[model samples]
Target: MTTARDTILARLGSPDGDPAAEHAALRRDYLHEHHPDVDLVELFAERLADYQAVVHLVPEGELPRALSRALWEGGYVIPDGVPEEWVSGIEPSRRAGADTDLTAVAGVITGCAAAIAETGTIVLDHGPGQGRRALTLVPDHHLVVVTADRISADVPGALALLDATRPLTFVSGPSATSDIELSRVEGVHGPRTLEVFLT
Candidate 1:
């Protein structure tokens, strides 16, 4: 009665693995935040920009207007659960699905679960405003909305807020890679452009 999961675990050399025991074995003394005095939101924006992602700081109650200006062209995909006010005036938005034509859209807009300052990563749990994997991956551009409260000082703090059982997408700027010749290229695996509007 060996299950597929059990077989996979066996292959990985942890057939009888105890989740609690494994977690306890890991070191917990590591410093969670490298710069305690630095503001998490500021640090996050800095790191994201360093990765070549465009970062915008939006004032409170102005997210809707900012979103409209960014995706003004209007062929973008809007996943379910995104706030109505966010996309209210933005017309011609496509609903994402398996049949979505990635080529036809300008990009995808979604909200993030948590943002890590140290790594400048946006972690999405594919819940609510955050869409499924394909909605974000197949598009050429990705525009995310990150709130100030969602910004974490470090990865450890960010992970504490996420659900491990849910599907997670950790985005650090746009998708890119370097070949053996040291030439860099963008848009290989995900969106070529990542624009973040921090509110």
Candidate 2:
């Protein structure tokens, strides 16, 4: 019995009969980063802002105050693995976990594994401080904390720093999509508002 998947696979069989070798033989000539001379932090900020995210450049010493002020409304969740000092003075409404009630929180605060400046994308590996997939997706707002050192010049540069085995989430901007009529909608798949604090 030929299943639908089997039929599809049979029709799309490897053309060269050696996909691995064929891929390895392909020419590869590409720049890893386009603007080597540009400051990654500034470039990342610019690109992030272009994506309609509220970007804040805060000093390390002032991050607590900034975080407190930004999350003053008090309905945010904090995930595990966030540095103690980072949220030392602020209190989150919920602590993210498997049983966390996503509907109760207005937003979530998290840390990213790496950020790509050229693409204005934040990559999350669901590591400590970064919660499970639902924590960021279900909330209406997401406040991401990014350090200057974590900023990469391009996607390749960022990919080099990430572990391939971990589940990864690449957030370019707030959830948005346009239909056939060209009507744009925001917050359709993820947070409607994205705010980033860069230190």
Candidate 3:
């Protein structure tokens, strides 16, 4: 049976090409940083927007009000460890975490361990305020709160803030995919809406 690699090898007239050597060559050393002087929070907001996420940047003291206004429609629940005051006006009845069934919940709010500006990704290590992976995933909407100090300038910087052995969940955007015909669909595997509050 002719595989894609075999077909490429045949076209290159190198049927004896070594796959292992090709793999090694592709694993070359790479850059670990970029734009050291650029504003990471700004970059993070821009990248997050690019992924179709609604990002809000608010001053530290204004978080509660900002959070209340964003979720005023009342369709979200806060995960464990998410400071009570952050979702104060949103109604405590909605908050739930740790082994809760989130499938029917409109959204779940939680804090993140670190955020990567370069990739616009939020990493959750199930830390204090961040709940289990399922808490953020099963719900159709995710409201994430990120502190300024948690936003890293690059992937390398973000990695440096994480513990290697912990269970890590990196969310780039609302779960979405395109079919073979190029039609796009969302919420196929995770939340279809991601609202981020970057403090």
Candidate 4:
């Protein structure tokens, strides 16, 4: 009567053992082996920019202005529902959500829920502050704001911090593809350009 799952479990060890303790031990070992001593936010910014992504740094009070500047430089007009206070000090064109066209937009700016330093990835859970999936995927360029406190050292670190119940988007670099002939192309599925702002 033993099922495949039961067979595997029996072969491995008793399922009655403390799963939480095993998980903690694994996490500790992983962190000790792979965690870097460098500042994650700064390291992530450097790596992202090195991969051809525009990099910026901003404080809490200066985020609005910085975002505005990035949008303007990228040739996008701000939307109406997007608060002026959310992006102040820069004058970009504004369009309605329905009217907004991806082909016309130079870029989209949003916040990231968490950033993984080991893999140089950003995780978005579609939170209110992070905006919708289309905002990052449709535009040719994406400007993501990542706070130092939210940056993690690796994938497991990031997963431990994120909620599984929410929608998650993980971006490592700009969208890219390769042809059968081995010719590489960028911006195939998502933003061709990725810019990171570490604060």
Candidate closest to the true structure, highest TM-score: 1
> Residue-wise lDDT of candidate 1 within 74-175, one digit each (tens)?
377778888887777566534445356877777899999999999999999999988788888988889998989999998899999899899999999999
C-alpha lDDT of residue 2 in model 2: 82
**Candidate lDDT values, in order:** 0.86, 0.86, 0.82, 0.73
Tens digit per residue, CA lDDT, model 4, 1-199: 8899998876555678776676555535434316566877777877776566777877778877777656544455343344455566656344325247767777776667788887788999877566777777888878777878888887877887799889999998888889999998999999988878777
- TM-score attained by model 3: 0.80
Q: Across residues 10-116, which tens digit of lDDT does each residue of candidate 3 receive?
A: 65555478766665566436676686888889999999999999999888778887877765343565666788777776656655545556665677788999999
**Residue-level error in angstroms, candidate 3, position 33:** 2.4
Q: What lDDT score is found at residue 150 in candidate 1? A: 93
Model 3: pairs clashing at backbone N, Cα or C within 3 Å: none
Residue 118, model 2: lDDT of 95
Model 4 RMSD in angstroms: 4.4
TM-score of decoy 2: 0.82
Q: After superposition, how far is residue 87 of candidate 1 from its true place, in Å?
A: 2.1
C-alpha lDDT of candidate 1 relative to the true structure: 0.86
Highest lDDT scorer: 2
Write model 2 residue lDDT over 14-97, tens digit each, in one string: 675677776576666888889899999999999998899999999988888887787634367788888878877675333444
- Model 2 ranges off by over 4 Å: 1-28, 72-74, 92-98
The TM-scores, one per candidate, come to: 0.83, 0.82, 0.80, 0.74
